[model samples]
Target: MLTDTASLQTVLDVCGVFVFGLSGGLVAVRRGLDLFGVLVLAWVAGLGGGTIRDLFLGITPPVAVSDWRLLAAAVVAGGAVFLLHGVWEDDDARPAGGRRHVTRAVRLLDAAGLALFAVSGALVALSRDAGPLAATLIGGITAIGGGLLRDVLARQVPEVLQRELYALPALAGAALVVLLDRVDLLSPLTAWLAVALVFVIRVVAVALDLNAPRALRSTPTER
Candidate 1:
């Protein structure tokens, strides 16, 4: 059972990396970045969060750096985007709907990546005997760190800082996993459910244009 669980975790992590890499590549494509830039962004988006998590845990060399398979996944995802983006592009001289399609695709992919990484990150932290608070924090970081880096590189505001409900869903999912683990109910099934929950929340939030409350204007003080 332990071996199977470990294998499952590895699979989830790899899938998350690949999905995030693809999302990153698509972002680069939307930004009109060159092929090399796309690849770099893909690698950074796929592995940036994991690298930060590993470093915080004092794991030397970071799995993102040492695991050739993860690197290959990023590279392959980037290459695929480079090869297939032209096919998706509307050859029309007008650029009207083209940007919308790309934006929608990027958001959907980002949501998937966010959900997968959140669960994987929490599981990894639990496996490493991290406390619940630490696990939740790490999980949120794992989900958003890569995208944050991607946006920064692309010269845009990170989504986490925006008015969206992005990090909330990730942290909520991570908290669910931790709670389940505390009750000794942490199974692969439960983990996947957590992932689904996060994904649904994020996607719905995006579709509905939901935004978290921002600071309201203060009323002027009467003299």
Candidate 2:
């Protein structure tokens, strides 16, 4: 069981990084950025969140900096996109069509990545003997921080700010993990169950095209 949990954590971490890196690389490609720029964005999107989480938890060296898995994920993501550049070109890659579809796919992948990172971060925090509140906060931040930085660097609004359900799903997942931990029911199975709940909610919300409350959207003139 312990081994399984550890393996799952590693997988989730790598998967989260991979998805985010892909999204970042895709964004660079959409902007017609150079290969170096794509790699830079991939690295930033993969590592930014865990870097912040580790800093907050005072984990020296940060998993992102210390672990080769993250670096590998970023490299794979950037390389994959760079290699696929020709395919995108051959497809005509209409910005409004191909780019939009790619962006939507990225958003969906991001939601899954968000769930994975939040659950992993909470588990790590709890393992380190942190309180539930701190664990939850760390988890939420871990999930959102990377994408937030990615958006900022790309000169776009962060998804969590513009989209109502993005960060909320992560927070819900983290909270569920903490709750289950308190009840001593939070094994890897339960942790994944929490992730599933978050992922489902997020997917449904996106499919329905949910938005932040009316009060949340800016006025058209503000645009």
Candidate 3:
């Protein structure tokens, strides 16, 4: 019988940030980055999405700046990755297949954070009186914004824009959130249910190597 409240949404938002932050740190580790890079990537990945969402919703100052929990979560995640990754070095004291072993982990974490943020963002938008379509769009943006920033900073192509079923699942979940709210069923239970649905869809797409169809084209000649 859990009810949706400000406290719950805040907790969900924090958890999303922490999880995305971990993925950021992992990406940094995989990229041969230094400690500072790990921290920067982590914070950017964690806060980028929420900041964008807040800005889009016309919320001044953005929670990523005003909230101490977000800062702690991002910093703690970066520190954890730095410490744990060092302990995982192979015989030569280099990271034990940082790319091979950590790549799947990064994708999985991205899926998780995407689901959490999508639902949370949708709920927040609904609470702020956003229209359903606007809420859905905001949710999708909030889910992927962090990863986009992280990948750009880490010098990798963003997964959302290029491949996989990333944005679809997030948008679907946000739409579901809007639906639930409109139906007067947006309780904590339903909120989490939407999260699970989005996560499952994204995870399944990853496992099955699914992708939305792109335009058919001949291979580009050397430009």
Candidate 4:
């Protein structure tokens, strides 16, 4: 039987996969991709992070590949988007707020995926007896890797590399999970709290259009 932590981690992982898949599907729709392209993007965005994480941890044939449910979730998410995108895209039939609604929905899905993946990744690392630093790093990677792959496949700049607080929030959440675990305070409640922290931070960053500081550049000398 799975322990409470393991069970919660599994739930988080599956939820993350679904949300990320939805995000990928939305992106595919925005990019005007075909049905096959939509499915491919969803699959990669849903499973890419977990696959990379498993490989990094030496778990051959990652759970994303070995598990059928995760794959189904991706396919379903993609198909749903492909079928329903027309509803949102019908400008003459769409409500005045339709475009704003779509944007908000996509942001929310991305935030949820990032938060859940961060927590799930940390929990998986902890289960593997990885150190806190490694756990934190893996968690952040797991959160961002899918989006990175999705953006690349869609021929856009990866959000994590952009001047957004995306990766930082994920890393912070993962670090928090590691810290709580180290102190024997890592419970389902704490894990969810960490996820919420990440979500809130990311949403706020997006709403505020926040960016990390860039290096100073010297002013050009007058000719």
Candidate 1, 189: how far from true, in Å?
1.0
- Model 1 stretches astray by more than 4 angstroms: 1-3, 91-94, 218-223
Candidate 3 residue-wise lDDT, 1-223, digit = tens? 2364688788888889898999999998878799999999999999999999999999999999999998999999888999987665552343445565678888888999999999989988888889989999999999999999999988788888766889999999999999888878888888889999999999999999998887798574544
Worst 10 residues of 4 by lDDT: 91-100
**For all the candidates, what are their Cα RMSDs to the real structure?**
3.8, 2.2, 2.4, 3.8
Model 4: CA > 4 A from native:
91-104, 218-223
Tell me, by lDDT, which candidate is best. Answer: 3
> Per-residue lDDT of 38-95 in model 1, one digit per residue for the tens?
9999999999888888887888899998989889989998999999988778564557
The TM-score that candidate 2 achieves is 0.91
* Candidate 2, 99-188: lDDT as tens digits: 677778778877887888899888777777889899999999999988888889988878888755788889889999889878778776
Q: Given candidate 2, what's the lDDT at residue 120?
A: 84
lDDT of 3 at 215: 71
- The TM-score of candidate 3 is 0.93
Tell me the tens digit of each residue's lDDT in model 4 across 31-100.
Answer: 7799998999989999899988899898888999898888988899889989988866785355546667
- The TM-scores of all predictions, comma-separated, are 0.93, 0.91, 0.93, 0.90
